[model samples]
Target: MPKLTKRTIDATEPQVVEFFIWDESIPGFGVRVMPSGRKSFVVQYRAGRRPRRMSLGPSTVLTCDQARTRC
Candidate 1:
Protein backbone atom coordinates (compact mmCIF):
# COMPACT_ATOMS: atom_id res chain seq x y z
CA MET A 1 0.00 0.00 0.00
CA PRO A 2 1.08 3.55 -0.66
CA LYS A 3 0.43 6.60 1.43
CA LEU A 4 -2.69 8.42 0.31
CA THR A 5 -1.97 11.75 -1.38
CA LYS A 6 -3.52 14.05 -3.92
CA ARG A 7 -1.08 13.14 -6.62
CA THR A 8 -1.27 9.42 -6.04
CA ILE A 9 -5.03 9.41 -5.81
CA ASP A 10 -5.40 11.47 -8.93
CA ALA A 11 -3.06 9.23 -10.80
CA THR A 12 -4.78 6.01 -9.84
CA GLU A 13 -6.41 4.08 -12.69
CA PRO A 14 -9.53 2.05 -12.27
CA GLN A 15 -9.24 -1.67 -12.66
CA VAL A 16 -11.50 -4.23 -14.34
CA VAL A 17 -12.60 -5.35 -10.89
CA GLU A 18 -13.13 -3.10 -7.90
CA PHE A 19 -10.06 -2.84 -5.73
CA PHE A 20 -8.79 -0.83 -2.81
CA ILE A 21 -5.55 1.03 -2.34
CA TRP A 22 -4.91 1.48 1.35
CA ASP A 23 -3.09 4.38 2.89
CA GLU A 24 0.15 3.29 4.47
CA SER A 25 0.13 6.23 6.85
CA ILE A 26 -3.49 6.04 7.97
CA PRO A 27 -4.71 2.72 9.18
CA GLY A 28 -8.01 1.63 7.60
CA PHE A 29 -8.13 4.59 5.24
CA GLY A 30 -8.25 3.74 1.55
CA VAL A 31 -9.59 4.48 -1.89
CA ARG A 32 -11.79 2.15 -3.87
CA VAL A 33 -11.52 2.09 -7.65
CA MET A 34 -14.49 0.55 -9.37
CA PRO A 35 -14.77 -0.94 -12.81
CA SER A 36 -17.13 1.84 -13.73
CA GLY A 37 -14.24 4.25 -13.21
CA ARG A 38 -15.53 5.81 -10.05
CA LYS A 39 -13.24 6.40 -7.12
CA SER A 40 -14.42 6.73 -3.54
CA PHE A 41 -12.66 7.31 -0.26
CA VAL A 42 -13.48 4.94 2.53
CA VAL A 43 -12.59 4.33 6.15
CA GLN A 44 -12.83 1.00 7.92
CA TYR A 45 -13.00 0.40 11.67
CA ARG A 46 -14.47 -1.82 14.30
CA ALA A 47 -17.38 -0.83 16.48
CA GLY A 48 -18.06 -3.18 19.41
CA ARG A 49 -16.29 -6.02 17.61
CA ARG A 50 -18.35 -5.46 14.47
CA PRO A 51 -16.39 -4.23 11.49
CA ARG A 52 -17.78 -1.38 9.47
CA ARG A 53 -16.88 0.64 6.40
CA MET A 54 -18.05 4.09 5.45
CA SER A 55 -17.67 6.07 2.29
CA LEU A 56 -16.59 9.64 2.75
CA GLY A 57 -17.29 10.74 -0.82
CA PRO A 58 -16.21 10.45 -4.39
CA SER A 59 -12.55 11.26 -4.96
CA THR A 60 -13.51 13.89 -7.50
CA VAL A 61 -15.50 15.77 -4.88
CA LEU A 62 -13.16 15.26 -1.92
CA THR A 63 -9.43 15.68 -1.81
CA CYS A 64 -7.15 13.19 -0.15
CA ASP A 65 -6.51 15.58 2.73
CA GLN A 66 -10.21 16.08 3.27
CA ALA A 67 -10.85 12.35 3.29
CA ARG A 68 -7.96 11.79 5.66
CA THR A 69 -9.36 14.40 7.99
CA ARG A 70 -12.71 12.60 7.93
CA CYS A 71 -10.96 9.33 8.67
Candidate 2:
Protein backbone atom coordinates (compact mmCIF):
# COMPACT_ATOMS: atom_id res chain seq x y z
CA MET A 1 0.00 0.00 0.00
CA PRO A 2 0.95 3.70 0.04
CA LYS A 3 2.19 5.62 3.04
CA LEU A 4 0.26 5.18 6.25
CA THR A 5 -2.14 8.09 6.50
CA LYS A 6 -5.44 8.84 8.21
CA ARG A 7 -7.27 9.07 4.92
CA THR A 8 -5.94 5.80 3.60
CA ILE A 9 -6.66 4.05 6.86
CA ASP A 10 -10.14 5.49 7.11
CA ALA A 11 -10.93 4.65 3.53
CA THR A 12 -10.17 0.98 3.95
CA GLU A 13 -13.29 -1.07 4.56
CA PRO A 14 -13.05 -4.39 6.32
CA GLN A 15 -14.02 -7.64 4.68
CA VAL A 16 -15.22 -11.05 5.87
CA VAL A 17 -11.60 -12.01 6.38
CA GLU A 18 -8.95 -9.92 8.15
CA PHE A 19 -6.45 -8.03 6.05
CA PHE A 20 -3.21 -6.06 6.44
CA ILE A 21 -1.99 -2.81 4.95
CA TRP A 22 1.72 -2.17 5.13
CA ASP A 23 3.34 1.25 5.05
CA GLU A 24 5.42 1.95 1.98
CA SER A 25 7.68 4.42 3.75
CA ILE A 26 8.30 2.33 6.86
CA PRO A 27 9.30 -1.22 6.24
CA GLY A 28 7.40 -3.80 8.30
CA PHE A 29 5.10 -1.12 9.70
CA GLY A 30 1.43 -1.68 8.98
CA VAL A 31 -2.14 -1.87 10.10
CA ARG A 32 -4.35 -4.90 10.59
CA VAL A 33 -8.07 -4.81 10.11
CA MET A 34 -10.11 -7.55 11.65
CA PRO A 35 -13.31 -8.94 10.21
CA SER A 36 -15.04 -7.35 13.15
CA GLY A 37 -13.99 -3.92 11.85
CA ARG A 38 -11.43 -3.33 14.56
CA LYS A 39 -8.15 -1.77 13.53
CA SER A 40 -4.71 -1.89 15.10
CA PHE A 41 -1.19 -0.86 14.30
CA VAL A 42 1.32 -3.65 13.83
CA VAL A 43 4.96 -4.31 13.09
CA GLN A 44 6.42 -7.44 11.54
CA TYR A 45 10.13 -8.14 11.60
CA ARG A 46 12.57 -10.98 11.58
CA ALA A 47 14.11 -12.09 14.86
CA GLY A 48 17.10 -13.74 13.21
CA ARG A 49 15.62 -16.30 10.82
CA ARG A 50 12.27 -16.34 12.58
CA PRO A 51 9.59 -13.78 11.83
CA ARG A 52 7.96 -11.94 14.68
CA ARG A 53 4.77 -9.92 14.89
CA MET A 54 3.83 -7.32 17.46
CA SER A 55 0.89 -5.03 17.91
CA LEU A 56 1.71 -1.42 18.62
CA GLY A 57 -1.78 -0.60 19.77
CA PRO A 58 -5.31 -0.03 18.60
CA SER A 59 -5.73 2.59 15.89
CA THR A 60 -8.35 4.26 18.04
CA VAL A 61 -5.68 4.76 20.71
CA LEU A 62 -2.76 5.74 18.46
CA THR A 63 -2.47 7.90 15.38
CA CYS A 64 -0.59 6.78 12.29
CA ASP A 65 2.28 9.13 13.10
CA GLN A 66 2.60 7.76 16.60
CA ALA A 67 2.50 4.18 15.36
CA ARG A 68 5.08 4.96 12.69
CA THR A 69 7.35 6.46 15.32
CA ARG A 70 7.03 3.38 17.48
CA CYS A 71 7.89 1.22 14.49
Candidate 3:
Protein backbone atom coordinates (compact mmCIF):
# COMPACT_ATOMS: atom_id res chain seq x y z
CA MET A 1 0.00 0.00 0.00
CA PRO A 2 1.02 3.64 -0.35
CA LYS A 3 2.32 5.60 2.57
CA LEU A 4 -0.29 6.35 5.17
CA THR A 5 -1.04 10.01 4.72
CA LYS A 6 -3.97 12.21 5.52
CA ARG A 7 -4.89 12.32 1.87
CA THR A 8 -4.68 8.57 1.45
CA ILE A 9 -6.62 7.98 4.60
CA ASP A 10 -9.24 10.49 3.63
CA ALA A 11 -9.53 9.02 0.19
CA THR A 12 -9.97 5.50 1.44
CA GLU A 13 -13.49 4.21 1.11
CA PRO A 14 -14.92 1.46 3.21
CA GLN A 15 -15.18 -1.92 1.52
CA VAL A 16 -17.99 -4.46 1.73
CA VAL A 17 -15.71 -6.23 4.19
CA GLU A 18 -13.42 -4.55 6.70
CA PHE A 19 -9.78 -4.34 5.67
CA PHE A 20 -6.50 -2.70 6.60
CA ILE A 21 -4.22 -0.43 4.64
CA TRP A 22 -0.75 -0.79 6.06
CA ASP A 23 1.96 1.85 6.01
CA GLU A 24 4.86 1.10 3.70
CA SER A 25 7.39 3.01 5.76
CA ILE A 26 6.27 2.03 9.19
CA PRO A 27 5.73 -1.55 10.14
CA GLY A 28 2.51 -2.23 12.03
CA PHE A 29 1.13 1.24 11.47
CA GLY A 30 -2.08 1.15 9.48
CA VAL A 31 -5.66 2.26 8.97
CA ARG A 32 -8.68 0.04 9.25
CA VAL A 33 -11.64 0.70 7.00
CA MET A 34 -14.75 -0.89 8.38
CA PRO A 35 -17.86 -1.93 6.58
CA SER A 36 -19.78 0.63 8.59
CA GLY A 37 -17.58 3.34 7.02
CA ARG A 38 -15.62 3.92 10.18
CA LYS A 39 -11.90 4.49 9.82
CA SER A 40 -9.47 3.95 12.64
CA PHE A 41 -5.71 4.05 13.22
CA VAL A 42 -4.12 0.96 14.63
CA VAL A 43 -0.78 -0.62 15.51
CA GLN A 44 -0.04 -4.31 15.35
CA TYR A 45 2.97 -5.97 16.92
CA ARG A 46 4.18 -9.03 18.68
CA ALA A 47 4.51 -8.92 22.41
CA GLY A 48 6.52 -11.97 23.51
CA ARG A 49 5.37 -14.10 20.59
CA ARG A 50 1.72 -13.26 21.15
CA PRO A 51 0.25 -10.89 18.60
CA ARG A 52 -1.36 -7.69 19.78
CA ARG A 53 -3.39 -5.05 18.07
CA MET A 54 -4.18 -1.71 19.62
CA SER A 55 -6.53 0.91 18.32
CA LEU A 56 -4.95 4.32 18.63
CA GLY A 57 -8.23 6.08 18.13
CA PRO A 58 -10.64 6.98 15.39
CA SER A 59 -9.09 8.66 12.35
CA THR A 60 -11.16 11.73 13.16
CA VAL A 61 -9.30 12.13 16.44
CA LEU A 62 -5.79 11.23 15.29
CA THR A 63 -3.52 12.32 12.51
CA CYS A 64 -1.22 10.00 10.53
CA ASP A 65 1.81 11.60 12.11
CA GLN A 66 0.39 11.24 15.58
CA ALA A 67 -0.52 7.61 14.97
CA ARG A 68 2.93 6.84 13.56
CA THR A 69 4.55 8.33 16.64
CA ARG A 70 2.38 6.14 18.84
CA CYS A 71 3.49 3.09 16.93
- CA lDDT, every model vs. true structure: 0.91, 0.93, 0.91
* lDDT tens readout by residue for model 1, 8-50: 8788888789999999998999999999889999999999999
1-71: candidate 3 lDDT, tens digit per residue? 88888999888888899999999999898999999999999999999999999999999998888888888
Those runs of model 2 whose alpha carbons end farther than 4 Å from true positions after fitting are none
Task: Sort the candidates on lDDT, descending order.
Answer: 2, 3, 1
**Candidate 2 lDDT over residue span 45-65, tens digit each:** 999999999999999999999
lDDT at 54 for candidate 3?
94
Best by lDDT: 2
* TM-score of model 1 (CA atoms): 0.89
Q: Candidate 2: what lDDT? A: 0.93
For all candidates, the clash counts are 0, 0, 0
lDDT of 3 at 70: 83
Error of 3 at 70 (Å): 1.1
Each model's TM-score, in the order given? 0.89, 0.95, 0.92
Q: What are the clashing pairs of model 1?
A: none
